[model samples]
Target: MKTLSEDLMLLIEREISGQASPEELVTLNNWLSADKKNIKEYQVLQQLYRGHQTLLRNNIVNTDEAWQKVSNKIEILQNSNKKTIIYRWYYVLSAAAAIFIIVFFAWVFRINNQVVTIEAVAGNEQFLLPDSSSVSLKKGSAITYNRSFKKGRSVIVKGIAYFDVKHIVSNSFTVITNNTLIQDIGTSFLVNNTITKDEITVFSGEIKCINLSTKAVINNIIAGKKIINYSKGFVVTDFTDTNILSWKSGVLDFPDVSLTRVLEDISLHYGITVKCLPIDLSNNIYVKLHFENQPIQEVLNEIKLVTKLQLRKGNNEFIFFQSVKNESSQIKKQK
Candidate 1:
């Protein structure tokens, strides 16, 4: 299901602010013109926004309540029409309202609560913090904090981040993720984020994992071990199963992951777009791919060579589809 379109975010600002720059206006016009369905889609979203506007203007809907209602509506829709049209429109409406509420409350809390805004797009990004610590961000990953970290202590994260945390004092720093909060004596780690979320290996040092939203957490895990959620709670894992920070070694580590997600990661790393046409793969396509020390095109060629996937250019870079050929290994099989 297509959850909200990215273009809607920009349009919300233009419409609400009523000060669209000449350039923005031109861009909007062009985008709407480029797609015959754009106007119809835009109108639908506008109608959705009006629902929120009515609640806001009438002061009948508490901001939080409105969002909660939206979330509740979302949960209901997800269960009933998971892969259907209702799921798509609900998400679009939900996210658009969220943006509006965030900006509105931001003004109200501007003086008291300084929210640190961070976004991770579909591309790999490098981060160097104030204390000389570093983080390598994966595509479609992100982390944000309400304020900056002080004394190399705990930091909150919303998306995947490989931390080369700066050395702190006798106390271990902490990292708060979606379902759990990790307390570290000193360590490097990886956190996988999604709408549902997951976590993995702590490369070095020890960590005390605790549930942030509930009463659950691992007692601790020393260096070279990993932790993954079993839904009930977190469990320890071994690096032998999968090496963490393999990306640092110039490879992506995917064990029975979705093929579309795999293509998405490749696109992010190569700064290109890749797709699988009419794509439906076993979703459990477990494969470890290494693209170390190679040019992006070479990487693409390698993937093509192995999967017999075809490369298509020009809606974006690296955008490719699996070729229609009966290859020996069109899709890698599990052992």
Candidate 2:
């Protein structure tokens, strides 16, 4: 039989950090609900992690020194064994010290195995994970993991990233977002975490999408598929627009995509605010356009031309609304 997948261990770590996405929470719940044994195992591991945290909070002593002191006391006890006065107490203390020494070293070893965090600011960054997996992070994105990646591969991701996970026998690659956890079976994928939704698009292989809150897990997301976790529910849809991820190549593509989402991307990339958007056009219209490192003003001008909207700029904020016939007539006269 095959060994247990490492994804389960990664889920435990996410739970410990309180970063388990709603989907991840759901997946964990499902696992626990499946069997009482699973719950017992999870609780035991949780207890161990908490114990380690407590030990780390307090300053640890030198193991060598501690062992030496215990040894010296044991030696003194052994030499005085002929004296019946405290022979029974010496045996008890010796056993207790032996157990304490073992526990201390184990705790120290666990504390030494720490997690590493990588972040991208100002621009995109590339990272080679400890397991030889490659990660591409967009600006403002981040990932965190421990050194034992190959043995127990997992990452906590924030913002947007492209992941090319390396496959290892019996090892699992998983990414945790704000609302979902992606367990990569063997795949390359893109993950974006935004305020309204978390999306995972698979380029190749397959992945399991887990809802952390509901303990619902979907294991059928495959190549050319995208899974989205939204406020009301989740959606798994197929996408054929190859350039959907053009942001990786400095190109932005909005193909019948929501204008609000487009504006959010613009704000994120250009570091600008676009406010006072008329609610009438918020969800009724879709925009189709491509931009290649275009200036902010030029992009706004394009929106005005395409949507027949008027923009007023003040303090780096652009306010736009549908143009009135009088305003259009005035612009025509000015031209």
Candidate 3:
């Protein structure tokens, strides 16, 4: 379907907000079971809906009751032969609804029409937020905030973004993701939510990074700190990887980082493949380098020179193994 009918959208919203009738619940459930995309669409709507108790209470203007009122107004208008009367009634009702939208839910979200979406479709896109804070969104990342930016200064981030929040007295800033909620107390930070891991790096402020599932403090990161959760165990590193946000400045800085980590970052940054052979080249071996708008080939050559490893190329994949004179059987291609 090109679009869901207005009644269906209202039913979905009612269902999400615990106001759907039993019949409407069954109808929605049946619709949802018909297609997996239906569930995703509902989730998108739910994510876009803000969760303030006052807003929720205000928006609970009953769908059935409001529709009945509109219907009654139409019936009264129909008694008059003038078509202009009907048009005027519709205009008045629409204006009232528009006022409600502006007061309760206004703009980007289609729930009575009010939600704002900020995305970095290309490279790093910088946004000057409504609260005078600043955000630099990395490619393929997005954030959704209220169109009016009322209630509080908050945003839900998708991929990676750097935030320089302008702290308002008594109002804190929050950056939310699927797994964590980072509350910033007047500071600068970087949040990276990649496919494999979720990380929060604080550069010039303190933040409370919490696990959404457990409500546990993952880390209370201070200035010059980082908290990374990947592959199960988490790492709370202090005063480490201060240059983590270097990618925002078009500089890939890795000072004394493991070959494994270096390659991982290279793969993510340049969109290339770098596989470390399983051979015990001693995991302690590290690389210290910085690349500024350099080609992947030059970066690869730098790795080859520093590690003395042979790079075997195969169809968009690069495998680094021990020198040819060393064990050749330990070569492994990274997926």
TM-score of each: 0.47, 0.61, 0.61
Displacement of residue 10 (Cα, Å) in model 1 is 39
lDDT, candidates in the order shown: 0.58, 0.71, 0.69
Model 2, range 158-267, lDDT digits (tens) per residue?
88999998976566677866567678878999999876778889999888987654546788689989988875568988966555555577677786766676777777
RMSD of each: 20.1, 8.8, 10.1
Error of 3 at 200 (Å): 1.5
Tens digits of per-residue lDDT for model 3, 263-298 = 877887776788777634525457678889888999
The candidate scoring highest on lDDT is 2
Measured with C-alpha atoms, the lDDT of residue 108 in candidate 2 is 48
Selected candidate, larger lDDT, 2 vs 3: 2
Best of the two (1, 3) by TM-score: 3
Writing each residue's lDDT as its tens digit, candidate 1 over 1-335 gives 13545775566445433444333444454444345476445444433444455445766546676567666666666556546656566676968678677745543433233234456675567877655668787666666542334422435566677877666765345555545656666677777754354675777877666644344656668777877764456667676634245445566656655666667776655556776665564243445466565777777777676555567776555444544454344466644
lDDT preference between candidates 1 and 2, better one: 2
TM-score for candidate 2, residues paired by index: 0.61
